[model samples]
Target: MLINETIITDIKNIIAHSKDKAIKAVDHQRTLMYWHIGERIFEEEQKGKDRADYGTFLIKYLSEQLQPEFGSGFSIRQINLYRQFYRTFTNVHTLYAQLSWSQYKLLLSVNSQDKREFYIAETIKNNWTVRQLERQIHTSLYERLLLSNDKESVLAVAKKEKLPSDAKEIIKDPMFLEFLGLKKESAYYERDLESAIITHLQEFLLELGNGFSFVARQKRIHIEGDEFFVDLVFYNRILQCFVIIEIKTHKLTHQDIGQLQMYVNYYDRTEKLPHENSTIGILFCADKNDAVVKFTLPENQKQIIASQYELYLPTEQQLMAELNKELENFEERDKPKKEIQ
Candidate 1:
């Protein structure tokens, strides 16, 4: 009387798809409902000539009458949100069906329309949850992306219209890992930090930028009787290359850079296929002296990169300061080369 395994598997897939579809349908209906409500409210407000004081009374009256029968979700705060949601989005045709009401609410809070649209594009492409949406906004991800890229490229990447050509397009120098729940002041080993990243792997991937897929942790390599373990390994589909990450909890040195270069070479010689691009190495450290990094690697190097990790998200002022410092260092590095030529 047992069911066939093939039949059972097919039934499970069907049910899973059905559940996902049902949830999506419910979300779409809710978003549309709010949009329609906002449209009605807007039309009603026009009778009062869009007067702010009349609009306030309208929302207040509606909230009081709606609360008893409809529920607390129709409170004054939520009513205001609904009005703002429609006002922000404006056209019904532009509403994203895939986004939830909560996601839209978060997007509406962003003041810059360009930034808001970029977040929307990213959220839709990444299938991010409401919490992820909130975290990205709070971290000022839009501003950070602007630090390296232009406004057009940032929007283009979020919309998946263009792929990242080099690491600079996707790599954030000071990676924000505040979501990992690790303290910057705490004394910890490299292994401890690696473990935290592995545990929060999803958040880690999001922080890693785009097209990265985790392949291994403590990846082991062997040559004759010797063994070496890499901290992390990932593949970037967009770059068509393997990305090797080495974790160092202290300041980076020439030796650390050399070690990472060797790892990249190992992957190129052994692990990489002829059709694939050269492997890239990322040396993740707590502190990086630009002088050490510049002098350690080949001046023409493209496959090696050094980036610092931060445990906390910085304020706008702090982020701007860091951006200015990075710009200054780049100019300094370019100055000597300009003089030589």
Candidate 2:
């Protein structure tokens, strides 16, 4: 009698799943083992206050003994990582079980406590792989978010303490697009840039900040027999509105802003449901003149945003200058309100 094919298939599937489960269990146990090592190291250092200065030597000695008996897993670098992992998450009870040892190694490098906490929460929430976590840290995602928002607000966003109430909170200026692999001095058409963004859509959306989902590409609309195409359209779940984007590969003009505003108006008038908020329009340009943007839009404009995109990451000095300028603008905006009060 021939064996049933379905029975054989089911048996093979079960073996594969069991193998995966066993691997996960082994990885988790290894993480626990490292944590215990770190905990013991810390406790020993604490008991002898004078020996606290010997942390460097202590880790080296442990690595020497452990590497020979237990394989190269106990290298000096890894021993230090374990020590850092414990220091970073002091409470053993709060250790994240889902994160691999590799992910913990990355989180240890984040210097800021608040920023590290944000990354931890995001990693767990999104189920990020080791590579994704590395990418977010490398691109300074936290610092970029801080560009348009206060520190507390950024923390709140990370912790889900407060939802984004406006477009500014979610729209990042000078978005980093190095992942697109575009050259800084390359002369590419608007269509080419748009296509590159679509190709690396996930990275582009991450650079765009939170709660955005792609709706359409070159979304077409008809107005009184004339047809216009919006470069990209997205819906912001947090803001409960449509985000219409127009790409300009050159310096932004008043006319460019006007055209984006027209798209915003069209969506607001015809597409938006009564329950949803006003649609937001973004003029994603290669360069924008502040004076031109200020004079082009109404003083009370809140929905239309003009943001510049960068093909590569900005230098630390350049980022600092931009941050200072943003802070100055914030102060100026608050001054009028404070004086009125």
Candidate 3:
């Protein structure tokens, strides 16, 4: 008697799937167990509120007994983390079974409820792995998004309360490319940067934001026997438009903006379907003068965007400094109008 290869393959797949499910089930149960333990600790602490060190003593003593039976998983540090997890996620109903203990641990570090909620929503929607979620948090994705958009708009889109109406809603400015393994001190050509992007394309797409899918590299366009090459091209499903990016290792100039605009026009005229929105052009540069970008494109221009790229991840303080600077600039811009009114 012989068995078919397909039948064996199917049985193997079933076994693999079941094993995965079983692992997930055990992880979820462990999460629940920790939550219940945390809840009990909290209740006990409340009863001993008069003693300042009662909560500390409670966790310390509990860990001593539990560690002897259950090993390091019940260590003092682990027990404290479980307690924090329970307090942070008071409503077990909101705890997603899909998220593992590691993912929840990362979320617990986020201080802001709104920011934590945003990461939670994004983690679920994007099906991000723990590493990916950690990278987003380290890169300050929330702060970068808020650089161009209001907090409400950023969170609303993350939570699916509203669909993104424009590329700016989802696209990040001052994009980080540290994952490309390029040193900040090293100078490279545009082609080098483009190659690095393609090499680490997955990380690039993640950094690109929500719905972008790569379309081409050095896409060629012909106009009256003249040849033009787009550095990189992508389609953003959320905005429903083709996004053309031109990389500039140097500071952005009006010429760079004009060149990007030409590529955008070419895409809109030839590549874009009638049902699709107009093409978007982005000058992915190392640096840019905002005034130059403002005056180069039309005042009402929505199709062209100039974004700076950073070789390294910025610290929270650095992002906050940039945010504060932007706010000051906004205030300066509005002062004249207020005086007139």
Candidate 4:
């Protein structure tokens, strides 16, 4: 009887594994099939004198014929998407099998091929879901990269074989925390935001970009009979270090920086393994005094970063204004200081 029970368990495991493999194989095949269909539709559209009109008609006719047989996957809109998909990704071989058709549809909407490729590569490398990919794209990940890095470095980081050391290298400042669903003038406390993040930890991690995994929330540490609580703790596998997040509902202050530095120091000395890199502390504040941030840290500080957090996604105009401000600040900072006699 025991032998029979063991055999049954083994059979069930085999069946589950087989089902998973089969599902993956089907998904892969479906992606390839869609790519091929897209290629064919694109070629036909190119040949048509009135390509736009003809493409619309083709998609409509195809949807009518295929929807009943293939169900929701073959709607007219999706057919149109497939056509655009081919146009966007002419090099079908580069399509990552891990990405679903939904992700490809989102990728198709991005105007820049380089930007699309970057998102695609990152999505595959990080194993981002369709929703996560959409969120990142909507957040203007490409634009953020442009703001933070040179063109060459941006491309390199996007296509690199490995992730970088700093979260700021990938994480966008003024992070869109609208997902927390906090009202702008709600007078919500820091603990409220922290609680939301903990509740939506998975989404938060996705927004945090790649290599982050939850370690703890409100993690307690005792040093020399003094007790302290860290708001959020995460491990970045790529950076090989602990990431300590301190939340502030108000503008950042030098005291906040000092507190975070202490947390980082504690983590580095006690929590971190010998093989791991130094701990990184991030202050997520509703506002940041740039001058305060600049002077509060050492000249070459890399471990601690003070970034503003926004309750909602900024509009294009707001982003542009911020960019202009940053540019002006850069110009001011770079202007040669008058030689002191």
Candidate 5:
């Protein structure tokens, strides 16, 4: 005898709901287990006066004793990680259930309490996955926050007390385009790079930082009788505006900036809602001349930005050097213009 269609649908729904509940239960149990382990480790370390050397032999001894009986998840490294995890999060009640072990691990690596809290809140608010959490941490999300907003404002935004005004509030210049996987001096077409980004959209979105959602690829726009295609368009709900992105595999030129400006203007005038903020345009290019960028746009320009795209994550030393150079240039530019008096 065949089941009725309605009955079958009900059964399917029940199974799906049961699966979801089971997953949540498993997650809750895992989180509780880790928290308990952390508590025990903390208590044990406190019992010993010299906690500094407490972890040295603990992992090795535990691994040797537990591996044979309990098997996997008892490695020396994992044991040490548990110790560190305990040290990082002593308050079990404060732990967020939404975040997984991997997310917590990434959070544990961050030294600043405030920064860690910021990431935790954002992760929960945005419903970011473990991989997304890792990417944000690796990209120095805290540092990016510092670069974009004032200390108090950053704190407010991180806590979800205030919404971002525009994409510029979150999108970083010198975008980390390592997801494209393009090698230096490699011969490839622009389409190939675009395809690569499309394939790795998740990574790209993570690198794009927060509040970005893919809108279209090769999005067509019409102005008067002329038609143009934008490489990628994204909508940032937090900002309540459309973000137009143009990808260029070559050095940025005056004409490149002009074209992006047109797109921004078009979105601002036509596509944007009456209450929505102005559309922002990003010119993602292989190279950009800072001097040319400054001269090409008005001093008060806020909508259009030219940024360099890197095909790989830079080493710590390299990132520091790049940041320092940019800071020095900014300071020099900020120096008061000498009076002709």
Candidate 6:
């Protein structure tokens, strides 16, 4: 009576899968328990609204009793957080099975409803882990996207309500490269920066924006005996185009734009299929003058974009400054139209 190895292996796999599902079920149950507790606390607090300190008194008393036998999760702070969580996410139906309690805790900190909704949609769509969500939030991904696009458009793309029609809708400007571990003061060559991006390719892709897949690096092209190499090439599934990037570790100039435009042209003429959209070119430079970029390209040209790169995640002050600058630019651009009207 010999035992079959295949049967034993199958049983082991089944047990492992069952354990995983059971763990998920228990986590979800715990989440539901917290929600119920929060719901009860809110209801109780509402009834005692005559007294100003009633809510505080109720939570403190509950924590004292619950913490002894039910464990530390019912501490005063935890109870308050649970109440806040309920208030933030009023509808339990909107709570996703994929999101854990830890992830919800992070989402609760997002003050803007629209921003939180966008994060929720992205987290579910991308299957982001707790750490990934935290990183995106910490790096101010939502605010960065808003700098280049309107709020509605950004939310629409994240929620999959609409597919991106143009690169600007998805690609972020002043792209953060803190994950590359490059020093802001370091004198990096073009090759050095390109190598850093390749080394942290996955994080770079996340920073690049949605639907970008790596195609090649230092891609060589020959044009009538002239040879050129593109620093990085990517294909965006959402926009249905090839994105060619040229790295410049110095202030961008008209010549840099011209060089990137040539790469874009080459890809459009020789590589892009008829059904696909035009090839997009990006001049990823250390610094750029917006006036120079605006004047360098043709008025009707939309394929070429010049974006600055940042070596580190921006502080809140830096983000606020960028937002203010964008607002000022918008106002200035609208002034002429307002006068005409």
In order, candidate lDDTs are: 0.87, 0.85, 0.90, 0.82, 0.79, 0.89
Better of 3 and 5 by TM-score: 3
| Residue-level error in angstroms, candidate 6, position 117 | 0.8
After TM-score superposition, the amount by which residue 170's alpha carbon in candidate 5 deviates from its true location, in angstroms, is 1.7
lDDT of 6 by residue, 164-220 (tens): 877888887878899999999889999999999999998888889778999999999
| TM-score to true structure, per model | 0.86, 0.86, 0.94, 0.82, 0.83, 0.92
Q: Write the per-residue lDDT of candidate 3 for residues 43-153, one digit (tens) a residue.
A: 999999999999999999998889999999999899999999999999999999889899999999898998999999999889999999999997778877876777899
Q: Evaluated with lDDT, which candidate comes out highest?
A: 3
Per-residue lDDT tens digits for candidate 5, residues 212-319, read 899999988877799999999998877788888888889899999999898888888888999888888989888889788889999878888776777877776677
How high is the lDDT of residue 91 in model 2?
A: 83
Give candidate 5's whole-model lDDT: 0.79
Sorted on lDDT, best first, the list reads 3, 6, 1, 2, 4, 5
Q: Give the clashing residue pairs of candidate 5, or none.
A: none
1-341 per-residue lDDT for model 4 (tens digits)? 34557888899999999998887678878878888988887787778856558878877888999999999989987787777777777887887767787787788778887788788778877778788888888877776656555555666677885457555677667677778888887887889999999888877887787778899989999989999999999998878999999999888999999999999999999989999999999999989888899899999778998878888877767876786677566567767999999
* Candidate 3: regions farther than 4 A off: 1-4, 327-336
**Deviation in Å, model 3, residue 133 alpha carbon:** 0.3
- List model 2 lDDT by residue over 137-245, tens digit each: 8767776677667888877877788988878876777677889999998899999999999999997887787788999999989999999999999999889999998
> TM-score of predicted model 4?
0.82
Q: Rank the models by TM-score, top first.
A: 3, 6, 2, 1, 5, 4
Clashes of each: 0, 0, 0, 0, 0, 0
- Single out the weakest 10-residue window by summed lDDT for candidate 4: 145-154
Please identify model 1 stretches exceeding 4 Å from their true place. 50-52, 222-227, 314-341
User: What lDDT is obtained when candidate 4 is compared to the true structure?
Assistant: 0.82
